[model samples]
Each structure stands twice: as structure tokens, then as C-alpha cells.
Target: MKNIWISCAGIHDTLRFTFHSQLKVMLTVMNRRKLLLAFLACPILAAAPAFSHEGHGVSHVKTSVTLRKRRGRTLHLIVTFLNQGRDAVMLETVAVENAQVLNAVKTAVPAGALVEAPVSLRFHDDVPGIFTLMLDFGEHGKGPVTVTL
Candidate 1:
């Protein structure tokens, strides 16, 4: 290219303006990114309490009874008893109550570290709709865990 004589002061002014403009654009982008992050984090922070028990501590004996497998009217479930406490807790009465079960539920859960009870539910009606299953963990007194399916 052909060399053109430009004033030193003019070159300094041009560079200063370019640097300020680029800095302003970069600052605007950073601000937008920060605002977007705050917006996205608000809901998760607000909904944290709903998902977990923040105030309520972990239960000593946590029981979960859910259906493992289902074939027609016969439903199979594995009931899990988790002991979070340091002491060994004996889960006495681990029972399931539903409309399908005709006789007494076979809950032979002996006192141990971790207990799992396998249960089978036989439905009377051909078409099984929404049924409430109440799990009774007597003496352990954790909960009669209610489940709907």
C-alpha cells in the first residue's frame, strides 16, 4: 500500500475511540450473560425446598414400596427399608394393605441392617385402575407409606 502521512494525535484519538467502543461492547455482553445466569438460577433456587426436605432431617428408617414388575392382575413389588441412623433398627411390622390383597400380607421382614420385603398383589377386578396401597411399618413407626398407581 502507499504510505500516507497521518498526525500522531489523530492516530492516538482513533485508537482510543476504537478501544473504548470494543470495551463497551464486551461489558454489555458480560452484563447480559450475568443477567441470564441470575434469571436461570432463580427458579432452581426457589424450587430447591419443594424437591428436598431442607428443614426436616432424614428419617431414621426410610421405607419405599413400589411396584417392580406387573403382569396382568398380579403385581410384584420390592419394599426397601433403609436405616439412616447409626443405631441398628428392627423394622417389626412391614405390611402392605390394598384392595387386591385377599388374606393377610406375607411380610416376613426380620430386624437387620437393610431389609427388603417382596410382596405380590392379586387384583380381584379384571381392570385395575388407580389403587391406593398403604404400607404399614409397625413399631418402627416410620410410616404407612402410601402409594397410588
Candidate 2:
């Protein structure tokens, strides 16, 4: 009877070990399948376009302004322009209220390229709350960008 009981205990232990090993393998395979499904769904999930800047003959003009610290009461304004178009476009001038246009220079830009044109405007005494920077494109339409500081 003692021998029979010892044999039964050994069999139960072996069964438990086999069950745990098989459960572990099943879980690992399930996790791997989930990871593969997630990886394959990435391109389908990212099919939509984020932002579209489609311009006609008149190129799209985007501007951004940044203010710098100055010694005197004058305020330094730096303007950046990005050309989102296919052809080359030129900027005529930039206007600001109560501020003089210090310099207007065009940086190197390629065809169908986005470029940055920096313009510095300095205020002598009074600073305007709102100002406008008009960009002239000869054949294309003019883009008037407003800035408020």
C-alpha cells in the first residue's frame, strides 16, 4: 500500500509540471501573435495625411515672428517665411507699424522647397500692438501676414 501511495504522488507531481510548462508556452505564443498583429497594423493606421499645404499658382506663404532682448527700449523682431509651393517666389517688402524695417534678405531656397527668410524690425520709441507684413509675389497673389506682440 505504501508503494502504491508513493507512485501516485510522483505521477501527480509530473502532471503538475507538464501542465505548467504547457501553459507557459501557450501564453508566450499568444503574446507573440498580438505583437505581430500590432506591428502589421501600423501602416494602415497611419494612412491619413497630417497637414496639407496645397497652393495654386500663388505659393503658400507661412510666417513666424520671434522677439529678442534689446539693450534700449527698442524691440527686435525676427520674421521667418516658409514657401510651400512648387516654383520659386520672391518677397517684395515687409511693413511694420512704428518700427523701421532694418533688413530684408532672402536666404538660399531651392525649387519646391520650404525656406526661411529672416527680417529684423526695430522699434524706436513706441511699439505697435499689431502690425502687418505684406509679401508681394509679382504674378502670384499677395500674402498679407499679421503679427501681434
The most accurate candidate by TM-score is 2
- Writing each residue's lDDT as its tens digit, candidate 1 over 21-76 gives 67777889899999999999999999998876422322566777777888887877
lDDT of 2 by residue, 87-147 (tens): 6666666666567777776444344566666677777676676778776665555677777
Off by over 4 Å in 2: 1-59, 70-73, 107-111
Error of 2 at 146 (Å): 1.5
Off by over 4 Å in 1: 1-58, 86-112, 126-130
Question: What would you estimate as the lDDT of candidate 1?
Answer: 0.60
RMSD of each: 11.1, 11.8
Model 1: pairs clashing at backbone N, Cα or C within 3 Å: none
